[model samples]
Target: MAARILIVDDDPIQRRLLEEAVKRFGHEAVTADGGEAGLATLAAARGDFQLMILDLVMPDLDGMAVLERLAKAGETLPVIVQTSRGSIDTVVGAMRAGAFDFIVKPVNHERLAVSIQNALKISALEGEIRRARRPAQSGLGFRDIITKSPEMARVLRLGERAATSGIPILIEGESGVGKELVARAIQGASDRRTKPFVTVNCGAIPENLVQSTLFGHEKGAFTGAVDRHTGKFQEAHTGTLFLDEVGELPLDVQVQLLRAIQEGEIEPVGARRSQKVDFRLISATNRRLLDMVKEGRFREDLYYRLNVYPIFVPPLRDRREDIPLLVEHFVSRFAAEEGKRRITGIRPDAVAMLSAFNWPGNIRQLENAVFRAVILCDGGELTVDEFPQIAAQTGHVSAIRRVEGNDAPPPAEPVIIESTLPPVATEDGLIGVAVSSGAGNDPAPFGFLRSLADDGHVRALVAIEEEMIRLAIDHYGGRMAEVARRLGIGRSTLYRKLKEYGLADGDDDDAGVAAE
Candidate 1:
């Protein structure tokens, strides 16, 4: 599909050049002379454009001001900043103002096109999330599964095949890996797509009421059972029933569930006879049902019934390649949900840190981390400082130390030097040996910094500095003067750091650094 792009630049020559480059990619291009004109054009044809190109320096409202205004107005169109040469400060400033990505001026057509393509991909992903949040009255489909990993793709293939048979299926994965999501995907893809997809968390319900919850209850079935209540199975008749955390179901409940599945009928807690009910069963669990059966915690017959068609979802750590796409998805999702357009995307270094860590809690953990970052992120690309847990989990001490202006010493060595005759020669030779050994053993912090410092990643360094200042301030009980005294810096310098880091004065919660 052809993408639509909007170019906002006061320079006529630059605008023409951008327009030509966008057309070369077979996309429709719209141009505006300045920020005001761009806003007016965007407001008029908001749905027409997929990406925006913004110039940092413009007449009658600069790029930062325009971006702030757009965010205030709740316009979330993707914007790539066009910065002048040697304008690192402006580039960082623009990024902090919510620019999607920035292109240094004296523009390279090849690089610009690549940047635009990436921004368009982000825009498309945001559009998908918006569609997912829409009312399900129209219909849900496999498109609800927002995954790009091979593991998920294979699971999806199996799910699609199993959805047609109407046989019982079990989804196995770590907690928060979206087991219910897979079940929903199956229901959406199956012949029962339009029918009700009832969900019940076996782990969340009390043991005493487990059977009643699944098999319905008659009036006066129990002390609190004042009226007749239909169970999840009955409600899901002619549709699909999703039993989450099925391993948590007690043995007695297991026998009843097995009977209901085999007979296609349910006997209410206080009823004399069974009522016929037909529905497909989709069970999910984070624990191993087979192991439970071996341990006598779960019944063997029930395990077999639920294991007829099992789907395993790998954790987020096993599929590191999908981290970037998932981060983009969550960023856009939370940004829209929170009604804040100040956040755009995560910094590449932060993405690297996320990819490196092991997500013990799986996709749910990652989602929570992203949401926490979004909430604490002060209107800019997310950075490593926004997620200190990632750095801690990944053992990125060297990276953190470098950010704190600490130089790591070389590895320890035991040596005894014997001086022969010339004192000057011996001293000089020892100094040379020490210098060479230090250089050989220790990695350069600047090199590590420079490697991740691509496309204005120096902004991440700024973020780290700001986080340090915030920590210092919090450590001193929001006392800026005390923090400045402890760091051996001036009070004004601390205040400037606070503003530079996008931290408000007197906000003392260290929760900002804790990646929820």
Candidate 2:
């Protein structure tokens, strides 16, 4: 079906241009001259349009204000902002206000079409997500799990099939890849959902008590058995039993577990009576069970029995495309839970840094980072400074440095430092020096310091030391002792450095301004 779009611009020529562009793609277009008229048309038509092409500078109502009003009214139609020539600030401001994308004046038809196509794609994906979340009566539908990636979707499908078949399932993935969430999703969608879903962490319990935990024990069974207790299997009868970290089960205990799973009965400790229990089983482990089996660490027969339906959850790094969505979800959840509404979103640079990192701990680590960032963030957007680890690990100095308003110049090109410094020395001494003037000629003894300062690489106190001393002197009315104390420098040394930097007697502020 052809998509319908609304074009809202004050200029007749621009509106006609956009209308022609929309028609060239075989789509329908509606045009409005200003924001008020566009909003009225939108309300009267009740979101009949699939997208909106809005002008950033309309006379009656601006594009940003219209967008804010639309968001307030719970309307989420994709919007593409149209900016005049050389209006980058307006374009960026529109984007920050939730515009899908922007196009400069004298728009290229090809680029405009591509942006429209992308907007339509985003709209379609959101529609699919909404449809996927619709509840099903049988509890065996796709709504039980939340995922967009093809790999996770395939796993959910396999899990759904296995849940109906009453076969044991083994989920394999890295730790914190949401293995237990998948297990619970399966249980929730199965016929046994109404029954108790018992879970046991094999690695968390002591080795001696694992058997008793899984198969129960009679009164006076072991040294501390006070009364007869039901095992996980018995407790989960007619339901599902999820064994997490199944690879951690000891060899001797594996034998008993294998027998209990094969047969529908368990022989409790110190009890002559054997009890029958019926339950579906689901197990998850991060270890390679096949390797363990080959090494005689895990029983092969037990592996086969549990491997009836194996599902693997891909790590977060493998599916980086989902990071943006996940960030939005987590930010909203955390903000609501913490009762803080000041934080609106994350800075673009921080998101880039987050996407670039190799998430060794998967989604769990990402969640923790977001939670920490949200807690430390004062208000507004979260920046790279909020996440020190991302900056440290990735060596990305700053995600973004905004040039406020139109007067500010565009950002400078990023400096790529390729150090020729040799392997760092163990002792506190300069290991290598910059060669200058001749082959391996270290001109100045402090050449490394000059290089670092010139390249704007100095950080923290050293970067601020010279400036702080000058500022303190000026603030303290030029008392040398007070300036030294405030700067945490000896009075004599302060005077020496001041003279060295040509700042003696307050000659020049530039002399004491360190590169940052």
Candidate 3:
């Protein structure tokens, strides 16, 4: 297939010559004067070029720097590295750093043509594989959750089971793993689908207003209580109340929450008496709430009340087989949403690249990447360039180059791997958590910490803890309760840490609204 190729060279003569050669090889060629210009060109017209021919040594931002930047940015266009300084070491280094193909200067036309052909062929093959794996459309109801991976399939089964139980359910997973989606799916599948499905981010509410926001308040109860406010529990009467980040609720609020759940009644702030309210409660957090109980941060009674029906959603990296299906789903959805008729599918190579990435941001991140790709797509296909994060991690450029040439370095140790799966659930519906020896594919215990230490930029435990909490908050969609739970701390401690770190102070002033 004829592709648009980019050539990055400091020497004008070399650039022009390579351009002519690429054109002759049945591809359109774009040229960049140096490494900086090449990167600039790529950023400006991302997704326009399918492959790049890059010169290793440039005056500014040498090929290595460009490669590093691309890796950091997660750009994935296959790159062929050309250098006059061609020694075995240089070529090996380039390949290791993500150069697709290494070619010596004084280029040979036949060799260049052959390399291009090989890279394109590999690219095409990957595209075909992805197309083969992609489901035509996602399933409905709980299956709308979308996955072929056994891990997520199990979670969905539990979710489906939880839907009809008519009991409070707790969904647990890292932020962005779709706790909200799971909650919605449960509500949708339940008998109460006709009724309201209310959601409240517990952490987003101010400490002073947690009780009022959840259980309503009389007019003039507090300084900003301009009107009689109905709480989420009242709004979700006879339906579902999804409390996201339940770990963020203050201790006083937790006390009231337990009472409300136990008695099916809530006394609004400044109300004369408790009013009965009926709603199916569904709570989610990314935290280890059991640990919170041990630490005395969470109310044991409230934790038990909410943990009656627990569903743990698996992270994306743990279910990579589902990625292609999700990519297709998102691509089609975003294409239609953006009115982009040309954006029908992603390149197979792109799918492979995406599947290999450990998506720390999970499905939401993938959705965002696909949305961006669809908007940026210049053609019918979403190519490697469209998904920079995947590209960078997969080292697509280097791998492609190695395939295109015979003279390349042997493979190095893998820098990234899929995230480890959570402990399997026992027949009793409780997850079995235990440490395993790294005898097989299992990673060493605390491997990530070892990696951090090995990097030599050792962080203070407090700093690490702060960052962990921050990440958990982000992953759990700003649900502080979930963050605290995941961090094995109490909501109170989480709040204290947040204040100490100068992080979010649980003071989202306008977030006090009780509306879904």
Candidate 4:
């Protein structure tokens, strides 16, 4: 989670302060004496730095000029600009030049940290969506991959090298790990970028038609062969051929597949002769082909041929660093598509919870979760409330029954409520309570609210008032007057509910909340 950041400033004091702040926030910081040095370090680092904190005012090469140069060079690195002048003109200019954010000089630690996080999140979104500018399937390059984890970095490096030739690549990973995307990237980066790129899911086709599907069938070659069909091999002539779930190929078809790889020729069913095809073969399988080979399901020779330049893409959980990036990108994309453009980002806690779950279905599952969260989001940002199912999986206490159409914001902790079960009268009208099990299941039992303060004495009136005030504040969206009125108390009584319950500044008219 600690990203490397470059701090650029002409003044040593400012640089030192920023560097300390960055380090204090648990990130690695590299200092540059000025703008020129920052750019030089960036050039040499070769994507080593995730973000830059640059002072806008410098001698020869100012922050604005640095940003312009970066944009001209097609760099998407995020920059946070700083200046003593808090003028709107400077901020607008910096933002126009692609600065992720602008902060006034002598930065506040909290503000600087927030800016750094937002810039990183935006940088990640840029990295993932940059591929959209190109063709979705065929024209994507290694840079289009959204990954900050070293595991994926290694995979991309291997893939880039394999893309330089017509090497037979056997991509191996769990399902939905983006194996097909890696294959397309390799093909796009290869010499056959403009040629046909055909994909075949070997497992999805019928067992009887697998051969005909891959090698084509002549007109009336079989019962359902009504027309002369061009196979995937022929379709990918002079380009790349992707075989997904190759481990599921029929045993007999494996022999024909081996021959095709060995001689680049495919014999269509009912055809006396074989036709040669020029295509780069890239096969992907979630299973271990070696195990299949041992079980006599997969042909060993065919496996060896296809596995020449193997690239293994790690699953989403293995590369946890990519989750936040992918989630942010998906939220942005789905929000626009759903016409909820106000939903810009997800809360850090939501991202943290997502990062903790081991995605059994890999990237595909994570993407779907984000898409659903975006659609369910009712506010400007996504929170845990938007991901109730996932939160329950993480053992979060959201199991309490929800009232339809109730839009009260989620409490910091489980909001204790009276149970719907047959009530046992305790005192006055207060009934026995039940605690949520955090599993979205019925709670067995928990005692009623204790009247004593653990000293064999009844609780004080102020203590009971404090608890009621806190609960009212959370339930009523922090409206102080409404909280006091609901509790049948004066405004003075509500003010006493402040500091202990996290409202540090309680002197304002509505406790800093404006009238809605």
Off by over 4 Å in 4: 1-7, 12-31, 44-53, 78-129, 136-138, 400-516
TM match of model 4 to true structure: 0.69
Q: Model 3, range 1-516, lDDT digits (tens) per residue?
A: 456799999999999999999988767899999888898898887355778899988888799988888899877678899888878899888998888798998999999987887676555445444443432222125744666678987888888888887888998888899899878878778787778878899989999878888999999998988999999889999888989999989998999999988999999999999999879899999898999999999999899999998888888988887787778677766665577755646666577667767889999999898898887789978987665444434434422222223234334442222235664433322222222222122121221221122122334697657656654664566766666677788876777777788874467322412211
User: Candidate 2 local accuracy as lDDT?
Assistant: 0.73
Return the lDDT, model 2, position 174. 97
Relative to the true structure, how large is the alpha-carbon lDDT of every model?
0.74, 0.73, 0.74, 0.78
Mind giving the per-residue lDDT tens digits that candidate 1 earns over 209-241? 898889989999889999998998899999889
Q: Which ten residues in a row have the lowest lDDT in candidate 2?
A: 398-407
- Where in model 1 is the C-alpha error above 4 Å? 1-129, 397-516
| Candidate 1, run of 10 with poorest lDDT | 427-436
Cα lDDT of model 4 by residue, 250-334, tens digit: 9899999999999989999988899999999999999999999999888888889988988889989899889877786687677
Worst 10 residues of 4 by lDDT: 436-445
Instruction: Give Cα distance to truth, residue 153, candidate 2, Å.
Output: 1.9
The most accurate candidate by TM-score is 4
| Candidate 3 segments exceeding 4 Å error | 1-140, 398-516
Provide the lDDT at 107 for model 3: 95
Q: What are the TM-scores, per candidate, against the unseen true structure?
A: 0.59, 0.55, 0.52, 0.69
